[model samples]
Structures are given as structure tokens and as C-alpha cells.
Target: MKKKLKFNRDWCKGCGICVEFCPKNVLELDDELKIYAPRSGDCIFCKMCELRCPDIAIQIIETQEESDEEK
Candidate 1:
């Protein structure tokens, strides 16, 4: 199944933490430094970006019980 990714732009600090940590290269930064999911189809739902985000800006919507607990 395709995993859902949510970015809270207001909460993001444009730190690039999530962009750097994503193993799947699923995230990217724009010219303005805002983070976005560019390779979302490659996402393994590893939750690395969500966990590494200092601003708690990235969220992986639940596709399983484990992900549900995270929210």
C-alpha cells in the first residue's frame, strides 16, 4: 500500500534534518528550504524522517497498528 506523508509547514524550521536522514531519498528541500516528499513512492514507511524531525513537522499516516500508535 502507498504510505501517506504529512508535512506541517508551520511547524517546520527548514532544518533539512528529515531530508538528510531519509534512507529512501523520499524527501527533498525546495529553493526556499522547505521540505517536501519528492520520492514518496519509494517510501518504505521507515518513519526515519518523522522520528528525526526536530520540529515534529513530518508525519506518516497510519497504514498499520504501529503507525497508528505514533499518532
Candidate 2:
């Protein structure tokens, strides 16, 4: 299974909390104070960014492709 995190630049405040907390170094802040998912596949669905963001700009979603047998 793989997970993804998406950043809403407009809502981000350029805070580095997410970048600092991510164990995989998956996120980086741009000059405009917005966050970007530099390493999307490295995310472990920790949800730390989603929970800690003050502006509610980060979202994490699971993207496990269901096998044909499961379907």
C-alpha cells in the first residue's frame, strides 16, 4: 500500500512544522511559504502534517490499488 499527501499552497502559512516532523523528509517549504510534497511515495500516512497544520492545508489519502481478486 502507498499513501500520498497533497498541499494547498494558498492555505499554507510557510511554517516548517510539517517538514520538521516528517521522518522521511517528504515535505519542503517553498520561498512563497507554501509546502510541497517532494517525496510523495515516502509518506507513511502518519497524518502528523494533517493534524498539526494550523491552516488545514494538508491532506493525506491512501492509494492502495485493489487487486482483481479483491474486487
Candidate 3:
């Protein structure tokens, strides 16, 4: 299974809690202090960031990649 990460920019308060708590180091803060998923490819869908986010800005959802049969 694949994991997709989404961020609610409007709800985010630029806190680093999500970035600091991500076990896979999949999250980071930009120069402007906004949170971003720079290494999302390394995400393991642990949901640590999502659960720990004070602003409820981070979300992790499981997804299935499109297969040849779906094309």
C-alpha cells in the first residue's frame, strides 16, 4: 500500500511539531516556517505527524497506486 500526505495550509500555524515528530523524517519546515513534506517518499504511514499536530494540519492516508488494469 502507498501512503499519501496532505497538509491544510490554512489551518496550519507554522509549528514544527509535525516536522519534529515524523519518524521517517518525511516532514520539514520551509524558510517561511510553513510545514512541508520534503521527503514524503520515505513516509511509512505511521500517522505520528498527523496525531501529534496541534493544529491538525497534517494528514496521512493510505492509497493504492493505479495499476495497468486501470489504465
Best by lDDT: 1
Q: How many Å off is the CA of 9 in candidate 3? A: 0.7
TM-score of 3: 0.78
Model 2 score (lDDT):
0.75
lDDT value, candidate 3, whole model: 0.76
Determine which window of 10 residues in candidate 2 has minimal summed lDDT.
62-71
TM-scores for every candidate against the unseen true structure: 0.79, 0.76, 0.78
lDDT tens string, model 2, 1-71? 54567677788898799889988888888777688876766777789989999899898755675421110
**lDDT score for residue 63 of model 1:** 61
The model with the greater TM-score, 1 or 2, is 1
How does candidate 1 score on lDDT? 0.77
Q: Write the per-residue lDDT of candidate 1 for residues 1-71, one digit (tens) a residue.
A: 33578888878889998888888887888777877876777888899889989999888875643342211
Off by over 4 Å in 2: 62-71
Candidate 1 off by > 4 Å: 63-71
Query: Distance from true position, residue 47, model 2, in Å?
Result: 0.5
